[model samples]
Target: MSSELAEIEGQISDIFRALSNGFQKMDKIKDLNRRSRQLEDLTDKMRESKRLIKEFDREIKESQYKFDSETTKLLNEKKQSMIKELNSYVALKKRYASNIDNKRVDLFEGPGDGYAEENVMLASTMTNEQLMGHGNHLMDETDQAIDRATKVVHETIDVGTETAASLKAQTDQMSRIVNELDSIHFSIKKASQLVKEIGRQVATDRCIMALLVLIVIGVIAVIIVKIVNPNNKDIRDIPGLAPPAQSRRLLWHQD
Candidate 1:
């Protein structure tokens, strides 16, 4: 082992030793306040131990490449053992803490809160192991409840994220639909304008055709008058509808 890792492991071992001795002291200490203080000190030691473990982990990661695979595997196993030891101490701390709290409550309860005579009688009859077992069971249930709540919260967050995405997709679709509707409306409006323009063009064409008809009819009347009175010099012959000339008409009359 490297010197740095050795020093870290020593510090961690010292903290664990202190924690084990503190927990042993807690058994004889009847004063709840003193026990509470001892647990607090042990808790601090546990924190330091955890910090050292993290340092150890970092050291292993930094130096594992220098060692063979077997050496590296041993190092990892050592870390896991330390973690299991720390967890046992943590469980012990929780057990003692619960015992102290329950004792405090039992000491100061009012009559209305059901500090019943039979319960105290039963507690007196029960052994320390039974009480500890019951407390452990309660702690386990509480931990399980917290785990379930955490799972439910994560699931709810996932569902909410999916719902938000779906809503966004629906909103985008609606926006596209509205845009298409607007385009269709604009096309209809343009078609209406074109129809109006065509109607005006057709009306103007009909008026021009009527004017042409009137001119053709007037020319035919003038030609008929000229034929009836050939001497009228004021009436001129139209190119296509009137007689060709006085000479052509005289030839026809002579024939």
Candidate 2:
């Protein structure tokens, strides 16, 4: 009983530890896309750990019946503690996500702000050819940034689609398992009723057989008593047991 909860608890702790390390490492990753991907991985790990915690809670509930009150209370307390830890991580993830989004917004808008000021200064001091060349370079950089953002968006979409499909498959499988369990429960109930009916029929049959045997024994006892005491009239006068009476004298009797 303890073994099951222990395994899940250990897994949750490991995943949480990994998430912490991943977040720390992500801080050092300067590329926006790489950091985003790293964050996604840690998010996935956090999700797994959340699932493990839920499973652990369910396991505790299932085993609670076997535990004393104090033990059950202690288990509940532990579950709450794990939940708080998970929530703290959840908060940390949200904070990091917000920060990333802010950075992304700046990445897109910051250059425009700088260019606005630069254009003013350059327009006053540069030659027409130099101005054209600088404009072209700025355009090229903007196009590259757009392309990178587009690629990141596509990757995120693909990941989301795959995750959705996997979750749906798991949901369907769980539904089938629950349905199978319900059918098995019904079958067992029917079998129990059938067994009870068979037992009743057997009991009734035994009672009838016992009655038949007693009746046969009673008849044999009466016959043995009559033979042992011939003067007993119980059967002596019975027409079938008596010696044939002398044939009634007939009008034409033969000697």
TM-score to native of every candidate shown: 0.45, 0.45
lDDT by residue (tens digit), candidate 1, 1-255: 889999999999999998888899999999989999999999999999999999999999999888899988998999999999999999999999999999998888854378467767877888999988877987998899899999999999999999999999999999999999999999999999999999999999999999999999999999998898787653334345555679678867876
Give the 10-residue window scoring lowest on summed lDDT in candidate 2: 243-252
Decoy 2 TM-score against native: 0.45
In order, how many clashes per candidate?
Answer: 0, 0
Global CA lDDT of candidate 2, please?
A: 0.86
- RMSD versus native structure for model 1: 17.9
| Candidate 1 C-alpha error for residue 239, in Å | 99
Pull out the clashing pairs in model 1: none
Candidate 2 ranges with C-alpha deviation above 4 Å: 114-255
